[model samples]
Target: ARPCKIVEMSTSKTGKHGHAKVHMVGIDLFTGKKYEDICPSTHNMDVPNVKRVDYQLCNISEDGFLSLLLENGDMREDIKVPEDPSLANEIRSRFDNGDDMLLTVLAAMGDEAVIALKFNTK
Candidate 1:
């Protein structure tokens, strides 16, 4: 699942280089667990760790699709199935029909860039 929204972000100067550098500390929406890491120097952006979580969530979504197919007795013996088979179509339909507000929330949290970074990392 996608993580809850970032409730807060705090920064602290790490050191005095030729220019000042800072690190970011953030808390998740539900757990409120705090995590600290360095920001990208050039952009002051969080160093794309959010993408890792998003990729994991995408894997979980795929697994959920597989589980659904298995439960519905729709999985084929062949691993190489067509991209838009019935199961795939059903999954896509459900995913598209469902108004998953969390997705929008994640997108607001810069998930698009994170997802792009995840693909590049792979």
Candidate 2:
């Protein structure tokens, strides 16, 4: 199965010589692209192993990527900054003010990205 979030789904009745079909419309969680497919109602589907972890933004690279310190104290520099313009500005501003930032990292099937950022007290 693709790493997408279901946006809509529908089922159609089976015709005289047809099997029932389930149609799903989804959006790729990482890329924000649309995906649609139809399959038999009995078809087994795969689900990606998505994990969310909270980390602290420890450093910002010259290229704008982030260095996040995980709960275990390990630093991750692999995930790039979010592509959303507004969120990126928010992160940049928050990081500049020496704020305690809580960064939520999302990972699935070895693919990871920064999904959320927020200021924290303490």
Work out the TM-score per prediction. 0.25, 0.91
Q: How does model 2 score by TM-score?
A: 0.91
Q: 20-111 in candidate 1: lDDT tens per residue?
A: 44455566532446766555455634333343222211211433322112324453221221133553454345445642211111232433
- Top lDDT: which candidate number? 2
Number of backbone-clashing residue pairs for each candidate, in the order shown = 0, 0
**lDDT digits (tens) for residues 1-122 of candidate 2:** 56999899999999688789999999988878999999988898888889998888888898988998877878888877888787788888888888889888888877788788877666
Cα RMSD of predicted structure 2? 1.4
* C-alpha RMSD in Å of predicted model 1 compared with the true structure: 13.3
What clash pairs does model 1 have? none
Cα lDDT, all candidates: 0.35, 0.85
